[model samples]
Target: MIRIRLGARGLGGVRFAVSPVGAAKDLLRLVGFSPGTLTPQWRTRATDALSRHRLGLLAVVGGGGPLGYAPDFIRPEPPAFLTDINTGLHQIATTPQERIRYELAGAVNGHAWDPGSGHPPPRQLLRALDRGEDHFAHRLADEMARFWHAALAPSWPVIRARLEADVTARASEIARSGLAEALNRLAPNLEWRDGELLVHMRTDSIHQLTLDADAVILTPSVFVDWALFCAGEPPGAPAPRTPLIVYPAAQADCLPPAQDHPLIGAMRRKLLAELSQPRSTTELAQRLYLSPATASYHLQILHRAGLVTRTRRSRHVLYQRLGGAT
Candidate 1:
């Protein structure tokens, strides 16, 4: 269990920010050989993409199979609000060499290997670390750049949209409820109580963190299923002992529909036909004699495909067919 003790000031200091660098790092885990217990469809997509690319760093980064660890330096705490991959990469590139080496050494020395499995860092990486090669840091950064370009950059638009939507929903929740409720809603494993946030982790050990003046930055990540915490620091400085928590983004009820899938296309067409007049998911479900869950699922797909547009009428969200979609 991880417990964070926040004072009155600390609790008030909580804020949310999006982290593209953190999300990209999480993608490495998602697309790795053993991405833990993801939804079947997402897992299949990530695995297929990794197989197609065959990145060399796969072994080094994914050595632990599904539970592998990437070196922490790749996603050092963002010095500022991260807007894009370039900003994130620039923060990483500008990190002092000593800090990079220190983190690498910690990753090497602190890594726990499974029985019969080699260490997480590849031999070539280890050699560079041991020899203190100045070029190793640059090479590692380059590898991350390549990985981003090849695997993540193309899909960033859809990914960013989903992330932004989640953030918007979360902000709404906070406005309607409170910070504690918002935190708990992010994941089932989290509980916010009197002056303390409790995190139920898979580990047996217990840990505690106290936030004094520095606010706890809550970052939303799509790839991580469980909550993770890392220390934050000002840009260009070493990380402090205390870290902010990164929790999994709340899952939308419906997965985004694949653009070219025949079934999805057919569903969108059906939804479009029914949506000539604006209809809520509940109304459409009742009219079609389908479960609300199923109706909402297909409706969201249609909405995302540009075949439908949604409008808010007081509390109800209504959808209608868009122009040019028969």
Candidate 2:
């Protein structure tokens, strides 16, 4: 059995066990918050209200409802709108995603409720809160943009007024939260220490480790161990006992393909060579002396051409070439 422990440095001695799922649960527990099941009915209620308010697109993609807690782990593929909003928020906020989480209590939801003790400085708190509210407003703007682009493309009036009202209300809620020192500690906290498992958490997912029972537990942070596990490979080749099945062939007409620019053609050739084994866009880009984004964009084009395929292995997307597709 794997054993893990965590320590709180200040505000008196406090400790918690590190579970297999990692630190998100412990962090939430410290704040007296527990995860709840996100049921379809609750989703329907929120979606319905959102639709009525013309915020349906944002709500659906953003994921709201009774099970809105972190561990509920229901984040859909964030719509491009949400992604762009999150990117902008990250650029603007000091803490980014951690500052805006809300919870239900005292008949009304409270912003930045901390069951865990300790207060930050009043100025920092205010800044964090302001950043949080700004992040939320940007998210709302993205939703409005999408809604306007699709449902009301020809008109400016439908989304403009609603966008104004939503932003106003969101901003007003930020004002009501009070810029007090204690009120601002509601953001999730992260700590790393020696001899304690450090589990790096992203979004709602736990980073996992695949250490052998006899292997040394060198790192206290689960995240460190998780990284080690990812870096290690399993022993031995595939068993000969494994079966392979050949599928019936389908006919296709041979046609001349559109020509690619010289740069694009060279990039595609490099990608095909690199994809003989799965490799992340970043790694491939580094090897090819290309920027990560440029590599990724070209990889997508290669993917469309059936020269490559991508699978998400952990946080990285790994690309592989189809053996005979080209």
Best by lDDT: 1
- Evaluate candidate 2 by giving its C-alpha RMSD to the native, one decimal: 23.3
**Model 2 per-residue lDDT at 25:** 17
Q: Write the per-residue lDDT of candidate 1 for residues 73-157, one digit (tens) a residue.
A: 6665655544677777766666677776655554565533333455454565566566553566555556666666655554455
Worst lDDT 10-window in candidate 1: 252-261
Clashing pairs in 1: 34-66, 230-243, 231-243
Candidate 2 per-residue C-alpha lDDT over 1-326 given as tens digits, one digit per residue, 9 for 90 to 100: 11123223321222111111111111122122221322233233333444666653243223322222221111111112112323433332322233233211210131122233232222422343465555544554454444323322221221122223333433354567632221122112222234332323342242332222222111111111112111121234121111100111111111111222223376687777778899999999999999999998989887654456679988989999755433
Where does the lowest 10-residue lDDT sum fall in candidate 2?
Answer: 240-249
Candidate 2: residue pairs that collide:
196-220, 197-220, 197-221, 197-222, 198-220, 198-221, 198-222, 198-223
RMSD in order of candidates: 7.1, 23.3
Which prediction has the highest TM-score against the true structure?
Answer: 1
